[model samples]
Target: MATKTRVPQTIDAYLAGVPDPAAKKTLTALRAQLKKLLPKATESISYQMPTFKVDGSAVAGFAFFKHHCGYYPFSGSVVPALAAELDGYVTSKSGVTFPPDQPLPAKLVKKLVQTRLAEIGTRAKKLAAAKKTLITERITDAAVKEATGHDWKAWMRVLDKAGAAGLPHKQLVTLVGRDVESGWWRQSIAVAYEQARGKRVVGETATTGFQVGVVRTLPMTAPQLWTWLTTQPERWLGPGATLNAEVGGSYVAPRRRGNPGVRGEIRVVKPGKRLRMTWQPDGWTKPATLQLTVMPKAKGASLHVHMEKLPDADVREAMRERWSKVLAQAF
Candidate 1:
């Protein structure tokens, strides 16, 4: 009689067939890291891999391959945010790979799990808010004019004259308040101005100061574009481009061929759509903010690069030129 074959049905059973003792050990360690970070999350088999769930949503998963062990956040957002620390490791849009001989660091794994949990919380809040505020009609020029005593174009011109684009959030609000008496109308005007200028959202201010760069329709989807921006920035920015795409994560773009490079921290990351980071170019005393937004177009995607709070006009113009070349190379 032929020997019976073992088929794994659970996480423990799945690990039983890992063959290599070292690989099995690594997988077990990774599992423990996830469990420690997500104490309340339940374990199950998902997509044929060991998965951890919170509130019935798949938060993370891990698998073993012939040469590598993989950790999947189940969302494309986490990989990019942890890009810098993941150097020398294989990574994809939604997962990271470690060699069977080398397991992921406990601290790094903890951070990844924490970041995903925070993202889940943020998305839940946004969904709840979306449900509460349902706008039946589109906001139009006529509506804005009727509500604020000025047409959209007129308000835009007023903002331009006031140099609102370069102003910090608090100052910009004060500037708008000067022209608009009603508090609600002031906020409305602020949002309108920001939108007209292609800014991200209201309450986003330039701490160090504002420069803008733009690259029109490139033949790529938003996710592909995001990969280009975060995965291999050195291809466009400089020789050494290391980016950690999370809030408070660090970035370093070393100078190349006499061109200046930048170093700073990431402030915001909305996967596939937006990324905002501080920009402190080589030799700069104070840092500025850089924001990249990807919008899906008919053919491909449009990328908007905004740098704010530079020291002077010269620095801003120089950065604008550098970014223009960078985008040209990128596309």
Candidate 2:
């Protein structure tokens, strides 16, 4: 009969008790991978396992046990797209378990981490986007106070008028279903504006110029991700010069003896949480803003990126698709 022991609090304690060498090696490799993924994560012993903190909170962790090695990214169930990939893994509310004798699925583990990280990045971007909405909410509230004098029914009428204009079926489900309380109301404002206008609701952009704004989140920590973004420019930018992460830094991409400078002022640099800089190439007419924001979840961080000042709707849509491709490659 198997005896159930109380959960341990530190990774050292769990490792000490586990007698399986394979499990130990698995744990070691996992730790190394996680370190590579999130170098900025602060380490500690919690629940008798290794826990990593991102942006001051625990985002993920690992543990060694008698039967299996456990890897947990606190918020993972929401990632439906990965369900097929994680099909064979043994999962629970807190984590997934990999057996000792069987070969550890390195790719799957990395995917899990990346997915969690992307979620965090999405959250961070939403928070930044939410701030923009908050201001609108305040204005709307003030307008209501002035016009209706606290009449709730009048507000409903205003909302109805707005909803009639915009057919926001998909966006509403995406934002509201995610429980973005702060941004939802403002979406209504967008809807209202759309309803009031007779403009056509066209799809994503088409110009290749916008394709340069590729945004993605990695499971790795800010330092690790930044290293890839800066050091691995050749992999993505097709022979880019280099990037310096400072106030007056510049990035130059050289293609066939011609050096094009991607230079701008670093707007918001909040260490590991956010980085926004101006990006203007020598030949381009408009200046673009490149923004990266990291949001932490239970076990990882999300990365939200935006390349603003795109020329037209078609270009913007193309940029969005480009970002998706970049994300798949990097994250």
Candidate 3:
């Protein structure tokens, strides 16, 4: 008669009790992979399986059965993204199974771990954004008055008298900045004024819009990069390009030969760190926002471009390619 084995209470004990040598080896390799991928995660035995957790949430788990090993991502969506790569394996909504004799490939395991980590990161970002929204929504008239020395009604009247209803989004925000001293109060007032006047405010996405962004590390300091962006854009853009270098200022890149020039209004200007503007090419139906952020690294600086509210997919891709070319030339 065969001896009945007791279920182990800890991850180490569980791995030690696996009777089949091949299964034990496979499990050990997987354990090592998980540990390598998630050095900060906690490992434990949960539900008679080995589980890895981060921030007290389960990110991944695994178990060995008689003939197969199972990989659990703790997410129903994670496996579906890699469906093509998992063609030969058995999969369900939350996990995948591979034969013990044929251990999961190292690359596939790495991809699985990465996907789980990304999912966790995305979830955390959403939660933080939601919390920020909640806090913003809780701001009251008293709070605005205390911060900016003016109540919501007073700010509304000021905006109404200033003809904010007729102004564009960028101009309205600039106007708000000038009227309210505190940055937080300024944003709150602008939102309230827009809501009262039926004007669209920030954080609302257009129905037919997309966003594209790219990052590049340049061999220069952030201040030097800022100078390049502001003073010498014509080197990469083209001759005759001009920038005003202040909020609410206009910029123009003159047409050369047969090409049409670009025009925009600077909406934000933070020295050596960030710049944001509204971009409209000669034939574009609507304007889009372009933001540049610079961060100092160990040796140089990293520049990032984020363009949003593009009208269509084609325009977005075209803009991406154009920016890629521009960066290639600039660097």
Q: What's the TM-score of every candidate structure? A: 0.41, 0.40, 0.42
Backbone atom clashes (below 3 Å) for every candidate: 7, 22, 0
Residue-level lDDT tens digits of model 1 in 24-68: 999988888888888999998754468788887677888776667
In lDDT terms, which candidate is top? 3
lDDT of 3 by residue, 1-331 (tens): 5433355667788889887888889988999988998899999765447888887767778887766778877665678899998998887655788877788999999998889778778867764665455423567778877877777777778878888887766677789888566776566676666656645423344232477776778899988999999888675556667888799888897764324578999999998899999989888867888998999999889889889978653345445545643664576
Cα-based lDDT at residue 158, candidate 1: 83
Q: Report lDDT per candidate.
A: 0.72, 0.56, 0.74
Q: Give a tens-digit lDDT track for model 2, residues 225-320.
A: 656665675544434446665656655545322224455666666766667777675676767777877665544555676776565443343344
**Cα lDDT of model 2 overall?**
0.56
For model 3, state the Cα shift of residue 242 in Å: 79
